[model samples]
Target: MKQICVFILVLMLTSCEYFNVKKTSSEAILNEELQTFNWNDVDVYPTFSVCDSNETKNEKTACFTQVLTTHILGYLQNKSIVVTHDVTDTISLKFQVSETGMLSLLNIEADSLIIKEIPHVKELIYCSLDSLPKVFPAIKRGQQVKTEFELPIIIHAN
Candidate 1:
């Protein structure tokens, strides 16, 4: 009788899910009902620059800074606000872009970690988007053609 009573108690304490198996797939969640970038229409263009000076006194360097800044901050202003877990106005990142216009993710170079005393609080970090290399167009009959654009963003949460 004691054994039967223990079994009954256990059964009563167990929730309906305790004995059931779940059948959800990660792929289904990855492709969650959302639209993604239209990679097919993306363009890549190179900015011309003089290799000697840190300051861009030439046309190419100026153009590079302009485009790079737009791509980097544009996403942050639109996306960072909705990062949900992000409490700060900006998300910091550590990244490197190859000389050939390929963007690489380095790390989240941040000094301050999240504080638990305040809920949803975040900190700002630095990213090298400002120094991203310019991709020059290919020369065809003394002309150039635009090709592609690539940028990577990194974030860390505590």
Candidate 2:
């Protein structure tokens, strides 16, 4: 009876041991990393050289927008787009700032008539946007990340 009890105890202990766990593949790792992260809100807003000194988040954002607007407006002053028809609309520009403080144009929203009237308007807008000064990207959880913004360009013609 003692030998039978000892054998049962050893069997239970051996059975409880875990074997080699299933190894994950590279594809599995990639898929696991494909989880989406929330980019709509960030802990730190993007900052410019002049705006970095601001103490509050709202202040910094306001300064950043002001500086960017000034830069784009300055660039646009040198270029002109003609509107053949009487129209009043806003051109929405979507852009992304890279993690390394570089700007890139993503999409532009404009009336088809505007595009037909001024075919090169897209190029002109891009040139203006590209000329903006470098700015630090937004940060979240101590890591720098790309940020997106939608800016509108109002067009009122008579």
Q: Kindly report which residue stretches of model 1 are placed more than 4 angstroms away from their true locations once superposed.
A: 1-57, 80-95, 111-134, 137-158
Which lDDT tens digits does candidate 1 get at residues 4-61? 9999888878866586898778887657633453433323324544332334334444
Each candidate's lDDT (Cα)?
A: 0.44, 0.79
**In candidate 1, how many Å is residue 158 off?**
20
Q: Give the number of the best model, judged by TM-score.
A: 2
What is the lDDT, from 0 to 100, of the residue 21 in candidate 1? 91
Listed per model in order, the count of residue pairs whose N, CA or C atoms clash below 3 Å is 5, 0
Please write out the lDDT profile of model 2 over residues 27-135, one tens digit for every residue: 9887776565565788888888888789988898889778876776577566765667776767887878889988777998998877777677778777877657778
Candidate 2 lands at a TM-score of 0.67
For all predicted structures, in order, the TM-scores are 0.29, 0.67
The lDDT of model 1 is: 0.44
RMSD of each: 22.4, 4.9
